[model samples]
Target: MKNKLAIIGGGASGLIAAIAAARNNPSLPVTLFERNTRVGKKILVTGNGRCNLTNTDLTEYHYHGEDVGFVSVALSSFGLEKTLEFFADIGLLTKAEGNEIYPYSLQAGTVLDLLRAECDKRSVEILCDQYITSLKKINNQFIINDIAFDSVIVACGGKASPHLGTDGSSYQLLTDFGHTLTELYPVITQIKTETDYVKQLKGIKIEAVAEIVAANLTRTCIGEVLFTEYGLSGPAILDLSRIAATNTQNSPVIHIDTMPEYSRDEITAILTKKANKQNGTLEELLTGILNKRLGQVLLKYAGFDLKYEISLLSYKEIKKISAAIKQFSFKVTGVKGFQNAPVTAGGIRTKDFNNTTMESKLCPGLYATGEILDIDGDCGGWNLQWAWSSGYLAGKSAAEKLKNGDKND
Candidate 1:
C-alpha cells in the first residue's frame, strides 16, 4: 500500500515539497494545499520577475541562527551543486550573473510554470483555496481540513510578504501543535529616516557606500543609494537595514559615503586644482563632481556659500565639505514592515526539529520546512535555495517514514 502525504501552503516551499514527495514515491498519494487561489505567488515576484533561483556559492554564513552547525548540515546535503542539477533536470536552463543565478530565459514566470507543469505531470493533487485552519493527531493519522493523511509536511512560509500568502499564520498553527517559534521580524526592506534632508534629497540616486555603526559592530556596503521620500532605499541601503532592524529600535544612525572610491585627501587635491584654474562659481564647480541637486543639498547642509567663486573658497570651508561627503550621517527611524520585506527574519526554532529529516521533535508524523523554520538567508537567492533543499528533505523523509511504517515517536 502507498502512503498518503499532505503538504500545506502552495508557495515555493510547498510546491517544491509536493513535487519532491510525489517523485520519490510514485505510487504514494500526494496532495498540496494552498490558502491562495494559486500557487507560487511569491515566486512570481522574486528578482523583479526574473526569479533568482539559487546562488552559485551557498554557505552557512549567509544565514542567521543560534545553531550554525544545523544549517551547515542542510547546506552540505543540498548545496549549490545539487540545486543547479535539480533545476536543470526540471528543464530550466540557469545562468549566473555574478553570485546570483537566474533562469536563462530570464523570466520568473518560466520557473513557476515549469514547477507547476512538473507537479501536474506527476499526478500530484493540488488543492487551491483550501486553507488549513488547524491540524490534529488522531490515532496515528494527521487530520487537516477533515482529511486524514499518514504524514504531513508544513511548508507554509513566514510573515515577510502577506500578499504572497506567507503572512506568519503558519506560526500560530505550528505552535498549536507544540512547535516552538521564534520572534518574527522583517528582513530585506527599506529604512525610514528622521532627518529633513531626506525630503530635499528625495528621488536622488548615486553610487555610494553606507556604513552601520552599532555599539561595537560596524558594517559597510557599496552600491547604488536611493533617496526616498521617507528615507533611504536601494540594494545597498536594504542590506544595511537588516543590521539596524535587528539591533536598534528607536532610530539608528547610518553614515553614507557619497564617494567611496576616492579618499577625502584625493578629492581635496582635485578640488584645489580645479578651483585654482577655474573662475567658475562654487555650484558650477561642484556640478561636474556630483549630482546638481545632491551637490546643492550638501552645500546647504555644510553652510557653504554656493554662489561664491571657487578660487575664493577658504581651506576650512573645503575641509568641512570634504568631511560631510565622507561622513554624511542620517537617522534610521524604522523599517517598511513585513508587507514590503523580501523575507521574514525568523520563524520555527531550529532545536524543535531534527536537522537530518526536518521532522518535528515534539510531534511525530508532523514535519516543518522552508520559512516556517527560523532559518533565513540574505537578499540574493539564499532563501529560495533553502526552500528547495529543506522541502525536498522533508518530503522525502516523510514519505520514507510512512512507507516503512516507522514509529516517529
Candidate 2:
C-alpha cells in the first residue's frame, strides 16, 4: 500500500517539504495544511519583501540556539549548493549581493509563486485555512482530525509575526507528543531602552557600530542604526537584539559608536583644530562631522553649552565631547516582543529530533522543521536557509521511510 504524507503549516519549510516528499516518492500522496488564508503569507515580509533566499556564508556561526552546532548535519546533507540547485530546478533565477542571496526578480512574491507552482506541478494537495490543532498516533500511524497518515512533518514556524499564522501553537502540539521546548524569546527585533533622548532623535538614521555589553560579554555589529521614539531599530540594532533578548536579566547595555571611522583622540584633535580655526558656536564645531541635532544632543550630554563659543573651548572639554560621541550607551529595557520580531529564538529542542533526517527520535514517524525547531539563524537569509534544508531533509527522509514500508515503526 502506498503511504500518505501529512505536512502541517504551509510556510517556507512546509511548502518545500511537500515538494521534496512528492518528488522523492512519486506514489506517495502529499497533503499540506495551512491555517492562514493562503500558504507563504510570511514570505512576503521577509528581507523587507526582497526575500533573502540564502547566504554564501552558510555556517553554524551564523545560527544561534542551545546547541548551535546541531545544524551541521542538516546543512551538510542539503547545503547551500543543494538549496540553490533546488530553487534553480524549480525555475528560480537568483542573484547574489556579496554573500546575501535574493531572487533575480527581487520580489518575495516571485519566490512564493514559484514554490507554490512547483508544489502544484508535483500534485501536492494544498489545503488552505485548514488548521490542525491536534495529532494522534496509533500503532505508529499518525492521525490528524480522524485522517490517518503514515508520517507527519510539523513546520508551523515559531512565535514571530503572529499575524502570518504561526503563533507558537506547534510547541503545544509537540508537547502533547512528549516533546520539550527551550525557553522561547524573540530575536531580530527592535530593542527598547530607558532613555528619553531617543524620543528627540526619532527617525534619525545613521551608520554606526552597535555593541551589546552584558554578562561580561561583548558582541559587535556594524550597520544602520535608526533611533525610534521608544529606543533603537535598524540592521545593527536588529542583529544586536538577539543578545538583548537572551540576556535581558543581565542589565544589557547598548553602546553605539557614532563615529567609527575616527578614534576618540583623532576626533578630539579635529574638534580642537576646528575650535581654534573657527569662531563659531559649539554646535558649529560638529556641524559637518555629525547630524546637527545629534551633535547638539551630544554637546548637551557632554555637559557643554550649545551656545558656547567654539574658539574659547578648552582641550579637556573637546575630549569629553569626543568620548560622548564614541561610546553613547543606553540601558536596554527589553525587546519589542514576538509580534515585532522577525524570527523567534527558541522552539522544540533539537535533541529530540535526528539532525540528519529531521525525524523525531522519540516519535519515529513524526518530524519537525523550520523556526518551530530550536534553531534560529542570524539576519541575512540564514533562517530561510535552515527552513529549506531541514524541510527538504524531513520530506525526503519521510518518503524514504514510507517507500520501505516502515510505517509501523
Candidate 3:
C-alpha cells in the first residue's frame, strides 16, 4: 500500500476523485474516507433530492472567488459535456430542466447508486464512518492517523451543513500543513431581513428579481423567491446570498423586483384600468397581479391603507405603489449561518494550489478540491460540476504521479 492514494471525504468530489484515480492507474490502490455513516449523504439531499448534477449555462458569472480564474484548467479539462458523457457512460441517464441537469429517474439516489457502482467497479475502496483525526506527511509518506499513502487528496468540504459531515474540523488538516484559508462564511444560503413584510407574507411564493445591494455591487437573480417568517429563501435568493456573504462586513440591502416585466408607467396604467373597469379596491387591483398577502404587504410597504379604493389613490400614491412593486427593499441582517447554508463562500485560498492539477503549492503530494477550495458556484448545478471537475483532476493527477514515480515536480 506504499504507492496507494488516500482521499479524505467520500462526498461528491472525494468519491469521483477516488474513482478517477483507480480507473486510470488500475493497480494503484485508491481509498476514500468518509466521516459519515454513508458516502454521498449530501448528494442525496441536493436539489431537493433530484440532484442538480450540472447546468446548461456554464460561465464565469455563475462562480465567485478571489481568483475565479483558478478553476479554468479543471473546468476546461472536464466540462458540462464531459460531465454528461461520464454520467451516461455510468448508465445514469439525465434530463434537463431549462439549464439545470438531473437524473432522468428524478431521484438523487439513482445518481448516487450509479456513482457508487462505478467506483466499486474501478476497485475504489470506500471507508465510511472513518474520521481522520490528523493528516501529515512523514518520510515521503502521507499519513492519516498513522496510516500512510503516497499521495492525499483533501475533499472534506467546508463548514456548511455539519449534519452532512462537514463539521469544519477537517480544515485544521490543511492549516496544520501551513495552508492559508480565507475567512469562511455561509453562502448559497437564506438571507434574514429586518422587514415585517416577509413575516406577514409568509408561505407565499413570488417570481421576482432578488437583488443584493452591497457596498459597491448590486447582484440580482430572477426566480421564485419564497417569503418566510425570518426572511427570504428560494433559488433566486440563494444565488444572491453569495453577494450578501461577501459584503457582510457592512450592512447590505436587499431589493426584490416583484414586477420585473412591467415598467412604472405600465403598472400605473394597469392599476388605473383595474379601478375604472371593475371599481377595484387596492387589494382587488392586485388580486390577480400578485399573491393576496404579498399585495397587501406591498400596499403597506407603499404606505397605503388596504381598504382604500384604487380609484381614490392619487397619482403620487400610485407612483409609490409602482416603486414598491419594482423595488421592495429589505435591510439584510445576516445570512442563515453554516448549519443552514447549502455551501460555503470561502475556503483554502486558490493561489495556494495549482488550478490545472489541484496540487497544493505549499505541500507537494497533497491536493485540494471541491468545496474545500476557494472556488464556489451559485445555486443551480455549478457547485456539483466543480466537484466533478476538480475531483477528476485531483485523482487523475495524483494517480499519474504515483504510477510514473515523478510526483511533486
**Clash numbers, per candidate:** 0, 0, 0
Instruction: Compare candidates 1 and 2 on TM-score and give the better one.
Output: 2
- Evaluated with TM-score, which candidate comes out highest? 2
**What value does the lDDT take at residue 155 in candidate 2?**
94
The per-model lDDT (C-alpha) reads 0.83, 0.91, 0.88
- Backbone clash total for model 2 is 0
| Pairs of residues at least 3 apart in sequence or in different chains that clash in candidate 2 | none
Q: Residue 343 lDDT in model 3?
A: 93
lDDT of 3 by residue, 265-363 (tens): 899888766667767567666888888778888998998887787778777777788889999999898889999998987888899898888998888
lDDT of 1 by residue, 317-368 (tens): 7877888888888887778899899888778888888889888888887888
For 203-249, candidate 2 gives per-residue lDDT tens digits of 99999999999988788999899999999999999988888988988
Clashing pairs in 3: none
Model 1 ranges off by over 4 Å = 249-251
Lowest summed lDDT window (length 10), candidate 1 = 65-74
